[model samples]
Target: MSGAHAPAVVFDAVTVRYADSPAPALRSASFVVEEGELAVVAGRTGAGKSTLLGAVNGTVPHFTGGHLSGRVTVAGLDTRTHRPRDLADVVGVVRQDPLAGFVTDTVEEELAYTLEQLAVAPTAMRRRVEEVLDVLGIADLRDAPLSDLSGGQQQRVAIGSVLTAGPRVLVLDEPTSALDPAGAEEVLATLSRLVHDLGLTVVVSEHRLERIVGLADHLLLVHDDGTVTDGEPAALLATAPLAPPVVHLGRWAGWDPLPLTVRAARREARDLRTALETSTPPPGPAVPAPPAAAPVLLEGLGISVRHGDVTAVDGIDLGLAGGEVVALMGRNGSGKSSLLWALHGTGPRSAGAVEVRAGDTTVDPSRESPAQRRRHVGLVPQSAGDLLYLATVDAECRQADHEARAPAGTARGHLDRLAPGIPGDRHPRDLSEGQRLALVVAVQLTAAPDVLLLDEPTRGLDYPAKEALTRLLRRLAEDGAAVLVATHDVEFAAGVADRAVVMAGGAVVADGRARDVLCDSPAFAPQVAKVLSPQRLLTVAEVRRAFAAPPSADGARDLGGAGGGAGGSAPYPVLGGRR
Candidate 1:
């Protein structure tokens, strides 16, 4: 361990260049992370954030086969002299895709695998495993199979496996990306406890800054040009290109020393709330009401999905119409994914009937071949990498073009729009999680299915990538494609979905307009909504549009408290229409 006065980790003019890359992944980066501090690494997609974290454990040069100049020292051990395994006792690293790193089949076995490899005593290993299971709130799943666990559960198991190893420095890459809001809070709270109580150092890279910025002691901004800038969280975020909704709200409202959390933003939004009391926002674009006899593009009747004895999706009826985007939301393990898979005709369904209207014919996807099903329905599962089998990005794109009989560069064109600058020759496995998802999305778009299902598509996307995806989905909807996105990202849901469908305990609990459903739920509300509560504002863009317009004649009129009118019956118009 480092001395009391020494920093936990240090980078001295570090530069890493991959064999295939044109420029250095990290160029002359230097920073020191103090002990017990939580440092968040933020950047655009494919901006070398992972490269910086990998350098700390010597994965850059030793494992990734990169040329490294300068030096990285962790816990007083120089990475140039020590490989990842050699520094295992001091540093714990978790990748964005937890399942990729998992070595065991069961949760208990996986958690104990690390300690057993370290040759810890049997009693100690057992005790540590139990402690981690409890700390991560996964004790009930201790004996469960890893394959059966939800994406969020798998993430917790991955974290638990590392914690049992007792590393001093924890480096997590998008640790909470797969988790629900409640689960993410638990994991982040556990990290905070470790930082404050155990004096452990944490360096995490996350796209959703809203969840972690409030707890971050320091921030590292990895620019697109491969340079890294480090400072206090608030100082860096003030001018950072990528920011959460709360920070955007603060900047829009011109609050000095911008607030990073909803609580802080709400505290500073007193005057703005008062100003918005009576001045109603402009109305949204008129949505053409569906005719009483409008035909549903896709319909599921009595859908029931089961895995072993567990009921993932109960009997439920759902319908998707053309030219609509729906956000499927629920806590982790809440049947959202199962329903998507069942609807796509790829997962287990004990009892259900899925019918899709393609052209003039109504067809059941389950009875069709994989290729036949693609023409009517397409699905991009949570593990997007599973869809790729080619050696290089170019090969994957070529295959997708051939399968869909699309133009030669059609898939590549979609990819370029979704996430620009991905090298064609790069192997699919070598791409980051966000890049992999983009590749799959591009491949699926080649089919141009009537209905598109994406599960956790924003798991690894940065803010810009998410915005691009939102625009793509919106365009697809406008082109008369029904889109269903299963996600835990409330912010993305608020921005992209016209309708929100919430599931819980394997059943549909609520379904309504996105603004009404998202703003009404405390657990699912976005930062902007939480900050500007009772006004029903869902996004920073909405708030900006509201304030940009001229104040109404009755702007000073008070309609009860901040809620506006009795029983909140008055409509709060947000920036609407196709986002």
Candidate 2:
């Protein structure tokens, strides 16, 4: 209640240069976030967003060993003078990777760990932990082992742990990146409540702008050049290079005020809808049928993975054809990642037959050596760090090239192509979240395996990076490689995947063409399809393709139409098999 009108966070011409860096990561940046304000930071990957967030808690220069100039103050405490540990009571920083921040084994203990370290009174700590558990709606997970929790649950626990400390300023880095749509909505709604009811000054950074843009009271754009732009969300998004489909549709339709949410777009889309009523634009291409001679790259018969008494993956029969891209989608702990690992033969499988075919040879991946398995079916795990070991990016790529028996720079070449701006001398751990995933993916791709599996490939990627990844995967699929991507990004799935396989309770619930499956599913539909429902429009690109000059004097074009409901009255018939 005190200092309510004061700025909770202030960056006064802050400049940060990391060790051995060519230029400053963040240069001459200045911004102020008032108390109780929900500010969202948006930028491309490796664009100094993390540096800005770290500055608030004094982690950038002090903990990260970066050269800092100028001043950053959180809750009137100068970050330069106060170490992160000292400022922990006022500023709670939750990292992009929840596992990195988790220190305790159980959810309850994790939540209480921060308060315990601060030496808060026993009774106060207990009350705070219980309040956080209920606030995050994770009461059921209080006694659950943190390791056993799914990615989304772990993320919620991480946030709850920080919340238990009762920091005035909450700083989160990509808090909902791993969450499903419903989980993301829940987390954002919780943040909104905190800002409104508790008046917490929440500063969050997210690459998925569509989900957070509308929730933000203020917007800060971190450009790659280390400059910053601060303004209202609608004003910043009007000219932002990377934005959601709804914003794109609003821009294309020339709405007076650009809409950041689907509800806003629906309200402003009446005129556009009327214009498209007369035009019956042809639907986009259907999912291509598998070739007649299509070799089954990877096939699983009666696949099941069990952990203790729980069956993570249960009796799932699936096949991935050459030259096909399939998306594995579901909520947290739905066995999508479990099945990916089991199919790649890395995880423990109680009962399964995983046979991968290359040319005239078909071998069970479960029995093959690591090297042979990499050559046959390469898998990039959800934690990409699992595949990286070398100190530097250059060293890792060289090791990958050597392991694949390729030229010295072959893997490095692949990495450069996948992520162009990544510094070769930088450590893999030093790279951005998106950059690290890209490096691991490119390293695996150097083997040129027949089958490629990626787990949550678009976690921290910006729209442009996601677009690049989409093109890369499509090209790989066209080159006769079988690509299986297990992801929470429904929009990315809608873009790159030909076939979609939805998992629930360790079994395949729905498997069909991307359009047919996503259009009908409420939880999986993209923003564009959600706004322009009943029209089968899935992407902004699809809407652009269907654009035609309206039969009017103003010379405007009919961009798209609206859908009836969440499931959408869109008559896209289901395809393929379902459980």
Q: Rate the local accuracy (lDDT) of all candidates.
A: 0.83, 0.82
TM-score of 2: 0.90
Error of 1 at 140 (Å): 6.9
Question: Candidate 1, clashing residue pairs?
Answer: none
Cα displacement (angstroms), candidate 2, residue 341, comes to: 1.6
Model 2 lDDT-worst window of ten: 570-579
Residues 118-145, candidate 1, lDDT per residue (tens digit)? 9999999989999988777889998899
lDDT of 2 by residue, 1-579 (tens): 233445799999999998778889898999999999999998888889988999999988887897999998887788778899888888888887788778889998999898888999999998999888888789998899998877678877888888888889999999898888888887788889889988899999998888989888999999878999999988877777767768877877778788889899988877766655544354544554677987888999999999899898999999999888899999898998889889988888899799999668799877888888889999887778777888998988888888888888888777777777677788888787778877888788888899999989787888777877777888898899999999989888877887889999999999877877899899999887788777666776666545643434444344342211112112111110000
Local lDDT at 17 for model 2: 95
Superposing every Cα of model 2 onto the true structure, what RMSD results? 6.1
Q: Each model's TM-score, in the order given?
A: 0.89, 0.90
Model 2 residue 490 distance off true place after TM-score fit, in angstroms: 0.8
